[model samples]
Every structure is written in C-alpha cells, then in structure tokens.
Target: MRGFSLLDSSGLPVAKTCFDPANIPEALHLDVWRQASRCGAQVDSLQRDWRFRGRTSNWYTDGVVFSHTLCDATHYQRTPRHIRRGDSDCLVLKLQLAGHQQGIFGDFDHFSSPPGTLVLQDWAIPYNITTTPYEVMAVSIPRYLLRGSHLMYRRNPVITWQPDSPQARLLVPILTQTLKSLATASAGEADAYAAGITGLLDGLLLGDRELLQSKYRERDRLEDMRQYLSRHLSDPDLGADHLCRQFHCSRATVYRLFQREGGIATFILRQRLQRCMQEISRMGVVQKGFLEALAHTWGFSSRANLARHFKAYYGITPQQAVEAARSHQNEGQREMNAPYWRDAYRVSRWLESIAPGASPTEPAGAHGGARQGPRELAGH
Candidate 1:
C-alpha cells in the first residue's frame, strides 16, 4: 500500500510503493510483505518473469475505508490461516481493470472473473487467488458497513459486467470517476464520501426493480412453483418431477430454484408439513389421529414419517399442534387460516391446462411466455 496520507505527519496514513522484479532488489519484496502484513493481507507468490512489475498505493481513511490499487503483471495472493482468523471483520470489493483472475471462496468452486468484474471477497474466509497480468482497484470496508445491503445476502463472489452491458458501458465509468474524486478529498470527509460510494455500489448490485424482476424470471418462476406446490400439497405424487412437468421446467431448473431451501423435495415436504399443521389447528381433537389421515392426504408415506418431519420443522409433534389448537379454541381465539386449498388446487389445474402435456425437461412458459434476459443474471 503506497499513497500519501492526509492524516498523520509520519507518512502513516498514506503509502505508495512500487515493485519490479527486473530491477528492484530482494529487500523490496520483504518490505512489500511487511506492508501487507500490517493490513492483514499477504502476497504469496510473484511471477517468475523478470518483466514482472507492480505498484501498490494505499490510503487509510481513518476508520472509514482502506483504499488501495494493485497494478501488476501476475501474482498469486492468499489470506493465510492466522491472518484470516485475526482480521475477519472486513470485506473487499475488488474491481478488475485489466486481465482475468480466478479464485475459490466458501462453497463456490473456482470462479473465473474477467475484467469489469466486481468481486466481494470476505476476509473471514481464506481464498486462493491467482491473477494474470492485471490492474485492480480494491476498497476495503468493514463488513458492518454492508451488512444490510442486498449484496451481503447474495452468497456469491462475482458480479460480472459484459463489455457492452449497461452497467459496463455506463456504471463503470461513473464508479471510476467517483473513486478518483474520493482519492483527492480530505480525510475528514471520508465517511460522507464512503457512504456515497456504498450507495452507488448498492445500486450497481441491485438494479431498478421492475427491470431486475423482468430479467430474473427464474426467481419469478420459483415463486410461482412455491405457490403451486402449496396448493397441491395434498397430492401424494406431487414432487420434483411433478413440479417440473407442471412448471414446464427441467430437473436442473427445479433443483436450482429450491437450492437454498434444500432442494425441491425438501421444500415440498416442508410445505406439506406446514399445511398439515393448518388442518390440525382447524379441525382440532374432533378428528382424533385425523392428523395422520391429513398427513396421508398431504403425501407423507406414514404417520411416523410425518411426525419426524413435523417435529424437525416446527419443533413440535402433530399431537402437540392439536393440543395447542384446542387450547386456543378454549380461550376463544383462532389461528389464522392458511390460503384455501381449493383455490390453490384450481390454480394448479389452470397452470397445467396452460402448459398441457409438457415434457419434464421443457422450460415452462417458453412457448409463448416472456422470460428474463442477460441483464437479470448480472449481479452478485
């Protein structure tokens, strides 16, 4: 990190450093590591080519943000075990300017991010990063600063921008200019400036709502599928393949839709258990062990299986739910009714009617249905 600091007289707030394997001495490499260690990052490898050259400029904005630019020929960097454990509170948004880089973080496999890519790297996890000849502008801001942003919940590393995409053509230049302006501003104004930068970043991460919704039709389809499943919870054969056929989507699409919910089968099981609870609350002890019959109607294979899933999901047994319902009735209170199954069933039938005799792997709504485009797939 090398940049002139506005704060502190000892060049403590800003540092600008350069490295050239061709001419710079070995001691400079040691000095680079020392500077990196102070900031909780490490440079694990340098390109062997004598042509390798790099520059790092770091600016400390007190506690607002730590900004740095790393321009280099090629390198491999890593957050060592001890460093990750000790400095696990910040997040880095690295914008690629030149060549491509690839890395693995958390559950994601190696992701190859090209230029114009904005990657959010978590300091809490160790990552193995390899970059080709590239120049990157990185902003280190506390995880707390972005805690509530949509990017925080995306659970992915990269936000790619195609060369001709609106974000790439328009937003990229805006961001670049903003960063440049921030570089010259006084330290006292860092917080205000940082906030603006973050706001712009949020906008870049989550574009206009209607447009975003139109682009990510998969999300819409998933929501529709959830509603459809809720209605057909009573169908014993209602499962992933059933959902695929009903939604006119493939097995992969169905799996991807419910990936976060533990897959389509798990989602269906949970919905069935939830519906059973509704019925239990509505019917109460009047239909003793009627809970088991309801379970059968809702696709659970047996009473024991229903109890297992019920207890796991609700932290209570079906019998316990019945007791709670009875107690509520005694107190002259009522559990809110779930959506009418008849309506859901009708909607399910309608959707099937529209798609009619569709193959399991065919995309739903593709025949005459509108779908999201490339823009919807652009964010974190």
Candidate 2:
C-alpha cells in the first residue's frame, strides 16, 4: 500500500537505557521508551537502532508487545534485559514476515526461522535471538491470557512448517496480509485491523492444534529446557555448554541460539538473579543468610554481582526493588506502574469512574436502602 503509517500517538519518544543503563553497558542500553495508547492495553514502547547489528527493535511495553522490524543485510541478536526485576512467568509468541529467525529459549532451539514460523517461546528467563534479512513480526502475550484467550498458546511459540498443510498455508498468509493492510486503512480501521491480527494470532497459538503440531518437536524441547533451567540452577557449568550437551546440539548451534545475548553465561547469571529476586519478594528484604548463600551457591560468586545484575534486570537494586515491592503493595508505585500497565481505554474508564463525581457510598434516595420504611412501608 502507498504511504503506509502505523504509529501510535498517545505518547512521546525517548532514547533511554533498556533497564537503567547507569547499571548496564552502553550497547545494551540502546533503547528509548515511547508512549503509545492504541490498543486496549496501557501501551508504550522502547525502541532502538540496530545498524551495527544491522537491525531495528521496537519492544512494546504493556500488553502483549507487538514489534515490527526491518533491516538490510545484517547480523542481529536481541537478548532482552528485564525492565522490572523478579520472577515473571509470561509467554511470548514471535511471527515472522520476511526474513529468517533463530532462537534458543531455555533448551529449545530454532536454527532458521522463516516466514510463517510462529515461535512460541518462554520469557520467564533469558534467551538469545537472531533475525535475518531483517524483517520480523512479534507479539508478547501474558501466559494468563492463553489459559483460554483464543487457543493459540499465547504463552508459547507454535512454530510450524508442514508442506502438506493447505489450511495453515492459506490462513497464515491471509493474517499477514491483513496486518499489512491495517497499515493503509483509515486510522480507526487500522487500529481495528491491528487488533484483529492480534486476535487471530492469539487463537492460532492457543488453539487449532490440528495445524499446530508440525513443529511439535520444538515444543517438547522447550519444556525440557524450562525444566533444566530451574532444576540445575545450582550447577556452575549450567549454561551454554551444559545446555548444548543437554539438547545434544553442537556448540555452534548453541551460540547461534543465544547469539550475542551475553552468551550462555549471561543467561545463567540472569536466571540466578531472577530466583534471588523471587526470594527477595517472598521472604522480605532482610538479608537472610541462606538467601545470601543462595546467591553464591548459584554462581554469583559475590553479592556485588548479584546486586548489579538485579538492578540491571529490574531497573532497581535488590534493596530498591524490595522497597518498590513494598510501596507497590501500598499502591504507591501506581504513579509509575499505572502509566505502564493501564492502556488508554482502561485509564479512560478509570478516569471516568473516579472523575469528580465518583464515590464508593450509595447516592441519596437510591434503591439500596431508600429510607428502609418510606411512608409506603407504614405497615411495618
């Protein structure tokens, strides 16, 4: 279509760190948050230029992250850092459009992901990514939505390639075409179309297994990797090599899976940090010795590394995260959290509900207790 445009207008753009770059490296900090209020979710994004790696990344920050990417010939890897620390159990689904993609989420691996590959991967921990030619479509949906949202395991990648399947071939292309058309429709129609694509993908991943099992091998492998990550967190050599061995895949294969995601070592450290974060949230901020030992026991080697990684992952140090947790419990961080979690529509509903006339108590002369015995109740 001519002059296709699909930019969200509720917020501004920013070139900021991915997490809190003061705590991370400059390269990894290549991110900026932009306000977006298009979808029903409290939407926003943190985008970055990936020319060095020859790529572009637009990480949606709110409801399922919807990313549209483009690039020339380039080597790209996106190892996302957690903007909020702690144990977050969510699923992510990546739909490819133009180029090939490869990813290693946990123990599962995708060597060459071509168009129509719906990669249902886990985001509870860290993973490495590589995208080629460089255009890809991705949407990150929370696992809770898939318990029944649309049948497409919103929490997993339903990547498939079955040459014999006509239905999958026909519909996947239609969905992609519709999404592209969304770019050219009336702004309102575009938004609706975008919304519809999200619905279609959600269903595909969570439902329609008759057409989803072509890549069942990858799905089973993913389950294995998730098990390995949690079960072997204590093993110091539990990263790339170990993962490669467990998957019975080559080292080169492993590297491609992780790409530049700080390599396998970084993934291991991040997972350990994530566990500590969960403990911090559950057991409170008091430095329990076992918890401190737990850090070293998991390969942190020292508390400093533990603290540093924690801050980088969550944008706040352990202590700060704990404090933020407490404050969040008290509805204090709503000042920041509300802006990120509640989309325009939800916020509007909130504003309308609590706007000047909002009240919890009943109105005067309402049905609930209208003078329990008004003159009509004289018989009482």
Candidate 3:
C-alpha cells in the first residue's frame, strides 16, 4: 500500500502509515510486530509457532485512529501495567471481516465476535483475547468524544454484536465503506468521516437501555436535589444531612450526586451566592442593612462574608455587580428575554409547581402518594 501525508483543516498532519511483514526479513518481523502493537496491548504469535504473516494500514486523524489489518492467529493481553501506562484511553470498535475471536474482559466477562460481527473494547480495562487468522477494520475513538458515561464500561468492557444484530447490521457496511474510502480521501474529508463515525457510535451506544436508564436516574436525582436546594436556599439547616433526610437517601449518595459540582456544600454555597446576586441586581442601590439582610437570608453570617465569596466566585464585589447591573439594565432586560433565559424561566416555573414538602417517592404533581425507597429512586 502507498503512504501519504496531508494537513487536516486544523493544520494538524493527517498521515497514513503501512506495515508489511513481507518488506522485512523474517527474523525481524516479530520484533517489529511487537513494537507496533505495544501501545495498544501485548501480543504474541508464539502459539502459532511465530510463523506469522500480516499487513496493516493505519489512518490517523484528529478525532480517531482507523486501522485495517490481516493477520495470523495471535494472543493479545492488556493488563494493569498497560492501563497504567496510559498510552491509549480509547474505545476500540473492531468489525470482523473474516475469522472468529473471543475474549474475557474485565473480570471474566466473556464475549465472542465472528466474521461480520462488531466488537467493542474499552482500553481502560484489562482484557485477554485470542483470535484465529482474521481480517478486521478497527476505529479507536477517544473516550471523551463519546456521549453517555464511562461508568457503564467498568463492569462489562467488552461487548459483541453478531452479524444479524441490529447494531451490526446498521454499522458494519458503513464502517467497511468508510475505511476503504479513507485511502483516497482528502484531509478535510477524512476528518468529516471520522466525526461521522464517532457520532454514529455515540448514538448506537447511547441507545443501550442499560446506559440510558442509568443516566436518567442520575440526572433525575440531581435535578430533584437542585430543586430542593433552590426552594430551601434561605433555610440555615439545608446541607447534606438535610438532603439525605428529605430525599430518603444516604449522605454518601447526596455527596456522590454533587461530586462534579465540588461537593454538596460547595454547590449549596454557590446557589446561595447566585440567589444573593440576583436579589442585589433586582433591588439596585441597596442600603447596608439590606445587604446584611440579603446575606442573612441566604445563610451568610454577614454582608462582609457574602462579599468575600461573591468576589472569589464572580471576580467582582457585590457592590460592583449592582453597579454593573444598573448601567446595563436595558441590555440585561434584552438578555432576560433571550431563549436561554426563557428556558430558565420555564425551569423555575416547573420547580415552583412541585409541592414544597414533596419527596422523590411522591408522584411528581401531588403532595401525597406511594412512597418509593432509595433503590427505586436509583431506577434499579
């Protein structure tokens, strides 16, 4: 195969590199093969008596790495050390064009992929696999680019869809055609193809019921907690324990739900500060006593304490924010009528619609109904 290089739209080099065992003497083939696959996994053809013949072509772009390979039976293993090396944090999707493969991924989660099948592997986990002489087209996508959560892969890192499976039927032909076309594609075209493939994979994966349900539960719980916090922002006892009691969940659950927001306490403080800012902006040219009252209502000890945190978070004092709001009243009014503010208004209206004492267990519309346990809230 011929090799070429071109600059992508972003000015990064897009290159296609090829490796053929036939180009080199037989004695050096194993060493070269080992080196080439090292970044992904440890591979050995010794079980086939090291009489290996293979050729691979790889296309590298900004979004993904695509490779086509024809190789003899080989063993591949990724262990803790390989994961720790952090050479690749990609989710690999391999479409089997010929032959069969099987693997034990992430603590004996076994899966098989036959010709015309598509297999997924999360490189963050350890795996062991052996394959018969096979021809495959594989794409490696950075984990961050994909939708949904990585937590879904922790227990079951390897997944396979048979030739007749819906996912395989939809993806296999498109992937084959795209990989074949990459050889002649311009840099701009290559990037577009890569992005298209990544988007398809994201849609496919997000369709998994397990992933969708898990995400829904988490999102619902977080939204519920946020609504509760918004209503109770003026309450001095609103904290993790209070959330646990109100939601009928453990303290750890509350903490984990807000972990991304820098813990429950921080989220509450930030919300309170935001409320204070909104109040000050609305009041305009407030007195010292009013500032103190606003601070106290939002759980701050004094105006001075609120000012310290407000400046730290927003990079300006409360007084300055008030002045700025006054000067830009018309602009602020226009912004308040924008789509984003409209959405926020709708959300606030929805929050107000919920009863103040309603818990997650109650039917969303009314104050009283069947009570659900934390497990139900988690969607398990």
Better of 1 and 2 by lDDT: 1
lDDT of 3 by residue, 105-187 (tens): 65434566778888988777777666667888998776656643253456447777878888888888778988888878766
Give per-residue lDDT, candidate 1, residue 35: 35
Better of 2 and 3 by lDDT: 3
Q: Per-residue lDDT tens digits of candidate 1, residues 318-342?
A: 7765664454333222221312222
Q: What is the lDDT of residue 174 in candidate 2?
A: 51
Prediction 3 TM-score vs. true = 0.52
Better of 1 and 2 by TM-score: 1
State the lDDT of candidate 2 residue by residue for 128-225, as single tens digits. 44334446555444433333232332233234444245435644565456444533444434434445545555555446665445457654554566
The parts of candidate 1 lying over 4 Å away from their true place are 1-27, 30-41, 49-54, 62-88, 149-154, 163-171, 189-191, 203-380
- Residue pairs that clash (backbone atoms under 3 angstroms), model 3: none
Q: Please estimate how well model 1 matches the true structure, expressed as its whole-model Cα lDDT.
A: 0.49
Q: Deviation in angstroms for 34 in model 2? A: 22
Judged by lDDT relative to the true structure, which candidate is superior, 1 or 3? 3
